[model samples]
Target: MRPIVVLLTVLSTLIFPGRAEAATTFGPREAGVNAWPYHDGGQLPKKYTGVVDNQGVRMFVHPGITGGRKMNHPVAQAQYGLALVNNYRRTHDSWYLDLAQRQARRLADTHVDARGAWYFPYRFDFPLSSGIGLTMRAPWYSAMAQGQATSLFIRLAKATGSAEWRRAADRAFRSLQLGYAAGVPWATHRDAAGRLWLEEYPGPNPATSARVLNGHIFAIYGVWDYWNVTRSPAAAAIFSEATRTVYTYLLRGFRNPSWASSYSLRGDVPSEKYHNIHVNQLLHLHALSGQPVFAAMAEILHGDFTMARVTATIRFSGGTHVGVAFRSTTDGRVRARRGLTLGRASSAPVDQRRRIGGQPGFWYHVTKGALAGFWVQEFPGRRSTTGPIATFPYLTRRTAVLAKGSHLVYRASGPSVARVSATSEAGIVRLGWVDGRRAVLVSAGSLRGLWLVVTPRTTFRIAEGDDHDEVICGVSCERVAPLG
Candidate 1:
C-alpha cells in the first residue's frame, strides 16, 4: 500500500526515480492513472491467460465474434509485449525478458516493408464505418498498430541492445513519418488546417478519417519513445507537431460540456470501456508533459464517469426546428426563454465543425419533445455568427442523360456540399469532385462505402473528367454557378 501511493506520487510528478539511465522508467505508463497493461497470460506449460498459440507464436486473444473464446488480436499482442517488457523492468525477470523477445520476433518476422518503412498488416475482415476510400474489401492496417509495434520495438532495442530490434524499430518508426498522400499511405493525415494527425482508422481517405483521440495519443507516445531513445531532431519535431495537433482539436471538436467526450472527430459519445480509457490516457499525457490543461480535462472527465439522466425541459431559448445545426458554446450552456432564431443567439458562440455530410449539424439544446433536454444534432447552424455553416443543397447544373453504360460530367452550379454519390457502373469509378484548390481523391466509390462526402466542401465545381456512372446527387446548399 505504501509503495503504491509512493509510485503514484512519483508518476504524477513525472519524476523518474532512476534518471541515471537513458529512458529506463519510460515507455507507456503501465501503472497509476494510465495503466495500459496487457495481461501476461499465466504460467505456460498447459495454462495461459487471454493468450493462444497462433501456429507457433504466443498471441493475445479477444472474444471478438467467437463469444468467450479467443481470437488473435493485433493491438492485444503488441500490448502484451509492452506488458512483458514492463514486467521485466519491475521484477528483473529473465523469463519476462525472453517472452518479450518472442513476442517481438513474430512482429519482426512478419512486418510488411513498404519501400523502407514497415507496417504490420491485419489480414482479416474488420467492419469499417467512416468516410471515403472503402470498397467491399476492408482496409489493410491501422496507425494504432503501427504506433504500438513501434513502441514495443523501441523498448526492446533499448532494453536488450538487440540489433534486430533496433532495425525493426527503424523501419516501424519511419511508418509514422509517412503521409496520407502516398500511393499506399501509412497513417499520417494532413488536415484541412495543414496539421498532421496520426490516424487510428484512416479509412480509405483522410477526408473523413476516424481522427481518434486515444489512437493519436498512443501514437504520440511511440513517437516520443523513439525520440527519447535516438534523440533525433526530426523525431523530436514530429512529437511536438503531433502534440500541438491534439491540443488544436481537443476542446473545439472532442469535448462536450454536457455529454461524454467524442471518441473520434466524427463519432458520438463512446462506450464506458472506451470512455475510461480516454480519461486515463489524458492523465498520462498530463503527467508526461507537465501540462495543466490535460490534468484539468482529466479532472473534469473523472467527474463525468457516471451517466446523468435527462428529463424533458419545458422551455428552450432556441425555438424548435428539425435539421438545423447548432454548435454549442461556452456562454450558451444555460437555457433562456427569449426565443432566438432556433440557435442564433448573441450570447452563445458557435464553431464551424468539419464533416463530409455537407451541412453544419451540431448539439442543439432540445426542449419540447419526448427527447427534450437532450442536445439534439438539429438545433443550430441556421444562422452561425461563428463561421460557415454546412449546407446540403440539391445542386443541378445541365444534367446529361448518358447511356446506360456511359460516363458524364456535371459541373456544380455554385459552392456546394456533395451529399450522396453512386458508382457510374458496377466496378467503374465515379467523377471526382474538383474545386480548383482541392480534390477528394478516393480509391473506390463502392455503394458499401457511400464514399461519405465529408466537408471542406470548397466552392464551385465537379466533374473534371468525362468518366461517369449514374446520377451523383449534390445537396447544393450554397451559392453555386454553372461552369461550362
Candidate 2:
C-alpha cells in the first residue's frame, strides 16, 4: 500500500517561491546515464531525525532545516541507491546491487498513489531561503525525485527482470506528466518561452519556477532512461520536450555570460563544484543528442589554459661545500616514476607535482617523508628524504641565493610536475659537493663576488655529482658559468 500523504498547502504565509539564491537539491552531484558514479551515499547515524524504522532508514530532520518536525527525503534516498548501484556496476559486487534493490522496493511501496499520479514526496517543510522556496510546506514533491525514482526503478527492472520495479517505474512516469497545480502537485513547469521544463521547484504558484539547471538536466536523465529502456511513446515525448528545452535555452537562459553557468534562470553563479557538474552535463547532453553547441560550451567552460609546467633544471655555484637536496619520489615536483636510481636503496629523482601555484623562485621536489607534498627552492629547512633534491647551504658572505623557477600549463595541478627556473651560461650549472668543507663550481666566476678559482690547478679530476649518483666534468664544461 502507498503512503497516505497529500499535497502540501500553497500561497500560505510560511511558504512561497524563491528568486535570488540557489541551494543544492538532494540528488546526484554528477550528471550522466545510468551506471554513473554517485558522489556521496547513505547518511551516518548522527544525521538521523531519531525516528527509526524496520527498513533501517530514518528521517534526517536537522534543526534550522525547516519549521516542520521531520520527514524522509525521497530525492536523497533515490540518489543513495544510485551510488550503490554504480558501485556494484564498477566492482561486480552483489552487496551494492542487493542494497539498491531494497531501496527501490522502499520507493515503490511508499509512493503516494493519489490524484491519478504516483508521486514520491518530500515529507518535511523547506527552510526559509531555500533555493526551491522561502517557506515550503510539508509533503512537497519535485519532478527531480519522480524522475530519479523512475530511472532507478526501470533500471533495476530491466537489469533484474523484476515486475515490481517496472510497475513502480510506470506509475512514477504518470506523475511526471501533469503540471504542478490544482490537485496535481510538482512536476512540470512551462516557461514564458513556452518551453516545457521539468522543474526542480515549481513552488507555491505553479506558474513560477526555480528553473534550476542541474536539476532539469538530472530529471531529463531519468526521462531519458525511461525512453531508452521501455520506448514508451509518452516517455519519448517527455524526453524530447525536456531535452529540447535544454538545447534551445541552454546558453540564453542558463549561461551567465563569460562566467560559471547560472544556478537558475535568475542570473545566480554556481560554485566550482557545480560548474564541473554543468560541464559534465553539457558534454553528456552532446553525446545524447549529438549537439555541437553543448560540446563547444563545455570545452569553453572547462578551461585548462592556465596549467603549470616545468621544462628543465638549473645550476648553482658552491664555493667549497654543497648541501645535498633530495627530490623525493613523493614530491609534487615529481611528475612520474622517471625510472628508479639503479643500485641505490633509498634515493631517486622525480620531475612532477601539483598545487605548486603562487610559489615564486625555483621549486625543487622534496625527498620522501611524512609531510604532504610542497614546493621548495634549491634549499629548504631540514626534512626527511630517501632521494636527493637540489637545495644547498654555504651561502655567499652576504647570503643572497639565486635559482630558476617554472610556470603552469594544461593538466591536473597535482598530477605531476616539471623543473622550475634557469641559469644564463651553458644553460646548466652543477655545484659539486665537497667533504662538508670544499665546494666545486662549474666555470664558477667570482665565487665570493670578487674571488676567482683558477681552472689551471696542479691536478683536476672528474668525480661523482652531488647526488652521488653520476659523474660530471671537473673543469669548465664550456656550457656553464656562475651568474656573477
Candidate 3:
C-alpha cells in the first residue's frame, strides 16, 4: 500500500507539472533539452536592482533566490570569465575574447575596494559618485573569487603580453594574504579525545565561521595560479601550506562512507550534506598539484554518489540533469562522531542566519542546480598539468628541470650535444645549458618570459654566464646573440 501511494504521488507530479513546487519554468525558446530553471525561475524583486557599469559589465545581478535574496556570489563571475576564455581559445572568436578581457578588467577595476580588496556586494544602487556599499565588510576575502580572478588575469597577461594584467593579479593575491593574516581569530573547541579544533569564518561573516571544504579549495587555486605566473617563492610557500591544511581538516572528513558539507577546523563533521562542488574542487586540485591525495579524495565523492537514489530528472543543455536524494551511509541521521557537538555558535542576525541557512540551506539553494551547468560547461573531466614541466614538444625533449636562484643546473651521465631554448614575448631564443662546462646564453639581450630546455646531456647546470671570469675557458662555452 505504501509503495503504491509513493508511485502514485510521483506519477501525479510528473503528469501535472504544477504539482512540483520547486520546478523551474523556462520560456519556450530559452529552454534547452536539459536546462533547469534558476531558483523557481524568478527575476530580482522590485526593490533589489542590478548595476551596469560604463564598461558594459553588469554587477549585482544574480541568478536564483534564497531567503528572498538574489544570489550574486562572485565565484560565478570568475567561472564565467574562464568559460569565455576557453570558448575564445576554441573558436578564435574575437567576441568571446573581448568579453573575457572586459570582464577581467571590470572585476579588477570596478569591483575592487579602495584598499585594493575585492568585496562581494549584495546590492549596489548607489549614485555614480560614491561606490558599491553594504558588502560583507570584514578583513576576510573570498579565495573563490580572488583565485579565479587571478587565473583570469594571468591568462589575459599571457594572451596580451601586458604587464598591467600581471600586476593586477599580484594585487589580488596580496589581498588574499591580508585576509588570512588579519581576519578574526578562530573559536576553538575540543572533542572527547581532547583534540582542539580551530574554526575560522568562511569568508561571509563570523556567524558562518564553520569551515567548508569547497571554499578553501578556491584559495588553493588562487595561490597556485599566482605561483605559476611569477614562480614566486612566497606564493609557493602559501600554496603548499594551504594544500596541507585542506588535506588535514576538510579532506580527512571524507573518511566516512559519505562526504560532509561543513566541518570543524579540526576536521570534525558538522553537516554531512554531500555536495557536487566537492567533486569539482577535488578534480581541480588534482590537476593543479598532480598529487595522489586529491585524486583519492575525489574517488570518495564518486563512491558516495553511487549510493544516491535518483528522485527526479530535468533536461539541461547537452545532457540530462538528474536530481538525486542522498542516502546516508551511517544510518540516516548526521551524527557527530567521537562525542563532539554538531552545531556552532553564530553572531549573524536572525534574518542573515535564516537566509544563510534557508530551507535547503544556503549552499544547496544557490549551487545545487547551478553546479550542473558549471561542472558540465566550465569544468571538464581532465585538464593539462600546471607544473613546471612543459607539455609542448617544440620546447624540448626533457621538461622536468627548473631554475634555482642564480643558476639552473642540469647534468648528463654521458657526453652528448645539448640544445636548450626559450621563447617569450621578446622572441624565440636559445637558453644556456651546459654542453660541457660552457655557459650558454640564449641571446645577449634580456630574456622575458624565459623557458629553458636541454637534451643529450640528461644532466647539466647553467649559471647566469654574466661572469666571464667564472666561465671555464676551454671547458666552458657561451652563446649570446642580438635579438633580430
Can you write out model 1's per-residue Cα lDDT over 1-484, one digit (the tens) per residue? Answer: 1223433432332222122112222222123322232322333332233555743345543455334554445576777778777777766778777777777887777677786898876655555443323332233667788888888899899898989898888898899888876468478878898878988777667875778788888888777677767876777777766766665566556665434567777555444335556666665554454443344344334333322222222222344433232233322333323223444322232222222122222233444443333333322123222211221111112122212322222233323333334223222112222221112223333322222222221111111122211112212123222110
Write down the lDDT of every candidate, Cα atoms only.
Answer: 0.50, 0.47, 0.38
Error of 1 at 141 (Å): 1.6
Relative to the unseen true structure, what is the Cα RMSD of model 3? 24.8
TM-score per candidate, chains pooled: 0.52, 0.53, 0.44
Better of 1 and 2 by TM-score: 2
Model 2 segments beyond 4 Å from truth?
Answer: 1-54, 66-70, 90-92, 128-133, 267-270, 304-484
lDDT over C-alpha atoms for residue 86 of model 2: 67
Error of 3 at 158 (Å): 1.4
Task: Give, for candidate 3, the lowest lDDT window spanning 10 residues.
Answer: 346-355
Sorted on lDDT, best first, the list reads: 1, 2, 3
For model 1, where is the 10-residue window of minimal lDDT?
387-396
lDDT of model 3, residue 182: 29
lDDT of 2: 0.47
Q: Model 1, which residues run further than 4 Å from truth? A: 1-47, 54-72, 129-139, 307-484
True lDDT of residue 316, candidate 1 = 25
